[model samples]
Target: MDFGLPKERTSLKIPPALGEEVQEGRVALTPQGVRELVARGHRVYVERGAGERAGFPDAAYEEAGASLVSREEAFGRGEVVLKVARPTLHELALLRPGATLMGFLHLAVAETGLLEAMAEKGLSAIGYELMGEGPRRPILKAMSEIAGRMAPQIAGRLLEAPLGPGMLLSGLPGIPPADVVVLGAGTLGRAAARAFLGAGASVYLLDKELSALEEASREAPGAITALITQSRLERYVAFADVLVGAVAVPGERAPVLLSRELLARMRRGSVLLDFAIDQGGVAETSRPGIYQELGVTHFCLPNVPALVPRTASHALTATLLPFLLQVEDDPLKVPALRQGAYLLLGQKGGHLE
Candidate 1:
């Protein structure tokens, strides 16, 4: 079988600075990923200590045939820039005009200034979150799986005293387990249901679509599945010890499902983990970091996987490598890549939908 590999490979850059305001330890390309790109004859320039936070030393990247370059050279010389988070304004300024940028560029919820800057630079930007067609989001799925699996542990810790009511997620032999209400029956929700179930919590998974709910039921047999109705949501939210917001809408901001009025009904000291915060969150009160609002502890960090940088970086590398390869030549030729092009060269906004 003839795999259509590009005859002329492109120069790729991996920068050290994370795009988000918060400290993100995960790097876009790992040493292993660089090795594969180099094997295919691509030139890879890695910024010094780019993968240090993710536990991949500079020596590993060097062994993989990546040139250790300064930040300026990495961003200035590459035809394509690979990043883990959306580029901050400072990092965005460093990119050469018309360079292709591939990363988790959440343009839907991005600041207008950032969008304008990209357009002014005439850059081509591809968002990993918006890459695939329905149910085919490889990069998003990998990150969501990591975030979902970590939810139970984070919630369990938050449920302890000082931050919470000092309740155990598993409860005692006679005591009832904590109720975990997971919104959205998508990949993250299903994974969260399984994790919460394993943690001995009573899991209730909800979604607007019956098909998604049915799928979640099959994936997590013991968890209860329900259609998200106003009455049902109110009842569940009122009693929920932990409310997890995993809802998402591809290429758009996450719809606000829980209003302040509804959130106010939750018991004092209850926890709310809004995984959808990256897409503007599923709750009206959810913000882009951990805090207390309306007597509820809210954990709404946009980059949850950054907590486990080593694992997250490796997983990201595996899922992103194939897409990176396809874009080396003509990105628009690939259906997924074309679909993910939020901002095309010399344009302010490409196809968002």
Candidate 2:
């Protein structure tokens, strides 16, 4: 099908992977997206049933110009591997030497042993979360929007009967709706605020920047926006029915904003949901917990967007497809693809240039 690459060009052996540990949705590349690469003179392999749980059947990939293969073959054949989550230790061993791996590396939280292994094996790795800075992160923003929108829904579920306080997020006439507090005015915080507001809850959004706080306040009429200070945040915590920690620093660990004492002071039936847990979290106790503790329920899954794999996969493909095509022409020479390569491999080895 040749999408204009040179006749003598080297094809990119790309394979899309299925997540092994994440019980929910995790396939990032869709069949339609894979077909785009196939049409561009790149060979794409889809692991058998990789996209099934994400609503893509094997036949769909076959029809979309992808070669369906076993997981071992998918890993063995590809010089460049695409995935949504970080590859496990076992999966890491399957990679061909010097293979390029791209996904949400979450290096701050990644195991030292794993990083060392990749170094020793001369593997090139790129992190989706750090691909671009600020709003420039098209892929990260798309997934963050999904997570933000789901924040209110997750909080609401926690407040439902048997699960939490038995209170509704949206109250009846003459009753007050839940108070939803979101930390950070970034893509994630804004999305969370909008979702909670749409559900008829009063939203309070806080950010370190005055410009951001003002922007959020102006954009969301009737919702409160405030500068983030320890005192101000602590006071708000006492009044919040749902506290969502979505604050993050690109390529760095998230700052801890809530202390145990402040958390204990929160309303007994309140919900503490930390979306930044994957980045070391924004609270002292912000790890995933099944049972509520400290008089509050905590929801701290690192891959929240993976809960809706189909939607996330489509969003991912939209952002990643262009780059995949660029790589086919000349992976090492293309400026953007080169940037990605350096980010993964560093200057130590594995095609840093």
Candidate 3:
């Protein structure tokens, strides 16, 4: 697709993700995915070692019809940029005016200054989270499913630490399994419930939507699904050995479901893992990485899937390739672009809407 000027193919760029040194994971496109895009007639420039951390060697990309370029060249040559995370202000500044930037723009937690920078640059920004509404948001669903599957594994490890409950999440014969409470019934929450169940934990899945709760129950036959209410939430929180907050709103900040008072009522050394931290968290006490407050250990990693970048990159690449192929047209007007993204961006003072 032209992406901008008619009859002109879009020049795409991929830069190496910056999460390696920082210990946060984010390389989201695989070399195989890149090959598919190139096969569709678009030129793709990948930075040297862009997918290295994600287990994709430079030679793989080279063989995939991608040109290996320096960091500066990757940024300078492309009319359209695709990345796993939002670019730094310095990276954004390198783009030519009106360039197209696509990635997961965590608008709610993002600084206003960055939005202003995007506006000043007149860049057309498309967020992965807002690519489509409901089931049409394939990117969000794919990533969230991976994150959900990882949640239980992460919580299981934390439970064995000094500050954890010091018990096996999946108990043995004649021993009671750990009690897991998953808040929200969306893709992430359902995936978490299934994983916990598979590990032999007794899972309580709660959500405001009855339909969502029903779906969770059907998906995980043994899981207990209940309509979330203040009393039910308080009761469950007090009894839970592990609490997972996976609530999300497509284009807005996730609502804080666990208040400080609610947190204080939980048992000491219990674990609270908030998968929703990327959008400002669903628990009042949740923060990025690990922390402790009210005697409860909170594990809130914004990019949980980054912990398994190779797998994540493959899934993300699958969802992104179709969209990339359509870039020859005006992507901003593509019906698949979630309208709520425009709402959120406009609300954040961006000019894209």
Candidate 4:
């Protein structure tokens, strides 16, 4: 993954620092990316199912000089394991002793069981989320940005006819721009703002925090408007052409910021993009679901991230590729994610003797 930093920063000795060192099809490492590694003389192993989603086949990894291995073989041979999600118990048990596992480990909310598991593993477990700033994981934030940007595209597809406030996104002369209300100013919110603005819509970004609101006001211009008031939130909600719910509360279920009364008051046919449906959603009516219907409209589609597999895959690759490089550099220093990383090197069975 591209960590948005220049390659060759001798300061940190991380693998992904090399620019374009890892290409998109690098489940086992593409030939191009692998050739670069081989030139440096590094033996690489990749687990099956790792590159499948990225349009990379098993042959590609083999062609790149990476030994095609099962999860067990890969973890056994690999001193460092880089993963998207925290490894399940099965995944974690496969690692060799002294192996370091790097990925997101969101243990802030007293996830002591996982913490205990890591300690028992006797591996130096580092969390990606903790390595960076507070509460936010950069990789997850990047993925959220992609998800938020896609919200409008999905909304547009769903609302092909009569999209809002009696005006079209590509309005004719005298027609106003579509109204888009983004309910959070975090990564997802800002991404949604940019996406909507690109679609020729007037964006109103709402957040309870002054800092977030201020950031939006300054970073996004023209079509983007930022506000810190809850009073007017309903007014905009009722009149919006699209309501994008990206608000989040981290480990806890996201509170319902938009009430049932307000939802009922919303303009008929206006779309609601509940991006946080997985986190209990930001709308009162939202449930943990892929699709939900309320009165005249549907809301709270979880797994919106899965809708664009190719895009999600690339986004993930861009974000985490550097971490893998970091692992390659030291074969240690497992950085846990800000939240929800489960992989660790040790399990109940015992470490490699």
* Winning model by TM-score: 1
TM-score of every candidate: 0.91, 0.89, 0.89, 0.68
RMSD of 2: 6.8
**Worst lDDT window (10 residues) for model 4?**
1-10
Q: What is the lDDT of candidate 4?
A: 0.58
Q: lDDT of all the models against the reference?
A: 0.83, 0.75, 0.75, 0.58
**Tens digits of per-residue lDDT for model 3, 1-353:** 31111111112221122122333334545777777777877777887777777678879988988888877667666776776776678787777677677777876678668877877777767788878645578889999999889877778877875667787989999999999999999999999999999998999999999999888888988999999999999999998999999899876788998999999998898889898888999887777767678988888766777778778888887887776666564556555653424433224323133
Q: How many angstroms is residue 220 displaced in model 3 relative to the true structure, after the best TM-score fit? A: 0.7
Q: What is the C-alpha RMSD of each candidate to the true structure, in Å?
A: 6.0, 6.8, 5.8, 9.9
lDDT of model number 3: 0.75
Q: What TM-score does model 2 achieve against the real structure? A: 0.89
lDDT (10s digit) by residue, model 4, range 75-111 = 6676655553444555557666556665444334222
Give a tens-digit lDDT track for model 1, residues 1-353: 00111111112221222223445778877888888888877888888888887798889999998888887777777777877778878777878888877778888898779888888899889888877765599989999999999999989988888788999999999999999999999999999999999999999999999999889988899999999999999999999999999999877899999999999999999999999998999998987767788999988887788878899999988987887676456565677776778888856444553
Q: After superposition, how far is residue 319 of candidate 3 from its true place, in Å?
A: 0.9
Q: How high a TM-score does candidate 3 get?
A: 0.89
